[model samples]
Target: MTAVPLSDDIALRIGLAARILPEIGVARLLRVLDSALGLPPTADTLERLRLRDLRQGADGALADLEPERLKDALAILRGEVGDTQPPPLPEPYVEGELPGSIRVACASDSGEQLDGHFGAARRFLVYQVSTAEIRLIEVREIDDGRAEDDRNSYRAGLIADCQLLYVASIGGPAAAKVVKVDVHPIRLGAGGEIREHLRALQDVLAGHAPPWLAKVMRQGVAPAGGAA
Candidate 1:
């Protein structure tokens, strides 16, 4: 049987679609695409296809695919690709003054977004967020063999110093455990860029912060307001 040819454009667009759709691996994405287009469920089209290596395989069968087709396929995708994650909590930033600093932990899979769950996060990107500064502290990766509760507790311990934690989501029990240690957990969406969120945090600091952020500022600086 002659196979349909793949195109570079199709591959690139499909790649973008795959990244947007959660819980879908490369193979599953192709199958979904095939099903959507009413093509037969033949694995031959992309059996050896690896999404990470898609650029090298676009020359084969996926060529000449229309942009409209890509859009249609994505529009009918099984689930919605949710909005980007929320930015860090707001705070005030006074230049060169010891206003205060709060350590924030962000859960991310690609370092591109705060898109990982509290319990499932492989690592947390730690940062020191001050009124006018944002600095990287470390990336703490998890490697515990304990059970679920223990692992959650352990992960919480790893970021004990961080006053605020941002994740894609957190189960109730895990949230309770984290709060027990005085670490505040904030939920962000699945697609927010960590760098962009950092800038947003800076903006929050530069403006009149909300109540929660006002507390952060209060904690980071003295009562005299903007330490000399």
Candidate 2:
């Protein structure tokens, strides 16, 4: 897709924001701009804008553009955009542990795929407990080599079922140990939904999750009366 030119105001805002939030991507930046300007959905329009030529000068960088361009750009982008579907709930996998039980399952990718795990990529599923049927969620994909800091930031808020899953390709015992420690972290993974779940579970015992997310998590697990 070709890049669209940003208005002088939009370009300045983006440049300033990129400086402040270096981790923010162009799509997210566009979202911020839309909210600030009360612009309608422009995903498709923005996608059409090419980052092709960036002109920088003493007055900071300004994307040169023709007149009456923004409206056309917005219309084109909106037409190309579509509704995004929620990720599919994963199937449950059970692995027995000494005192507790570990269950694994995969969450369907929404639209984006992890860097490495393309065709062979499968989300990792982990659950502990037998009768209760609580599963810890983790996604594994081929390492795309992008910085993990921003991507892993959301680990904190993963629904109780979804936790960050890191898999070691080779070896047996060491990998098992890593997986165990990740599940029972002394500290929750950095930011995002997963951290929120960890904090919520800290005070309460297992089986506690935020109400909204709990609904989805329960659906992914087996029924209370159902066998493991």
Q: For every model shown, what is its TM-score relative to the native structure?
A: 0.51, 0.24
Q: What total of clashing residue pairs does each candidate reach?
A: 13, 32
- lDDT for position 175 in model 2: 28
**Cα lDDT tens digits for candidate 1, 45-146:** 333333322322233232233332233234223112222343334345333343466677887655446766665555677776765667665666655443
The 10-residue segment with the lowest total lDDT in model 2: 113-122
lDDT of each: 0.55, 0.32
Q: Model 1 misses residue 209 by how many Å?
A: 1.8
Error of 1 at 153 (Å): 1.6
Candidate 2, residues 1-228, lDDT tens digits: the string is: 235565654454344333323344455545544433334323344454432312221121323422122222322232321114333343444333213332322222233221111111123323333333444433332232332443222221231232323221212332233344332222221222332343344334345645643443344433211111
lDDT value for model 2: 0.32
* Worst ten in a row by lDDT for model 1: 219-228
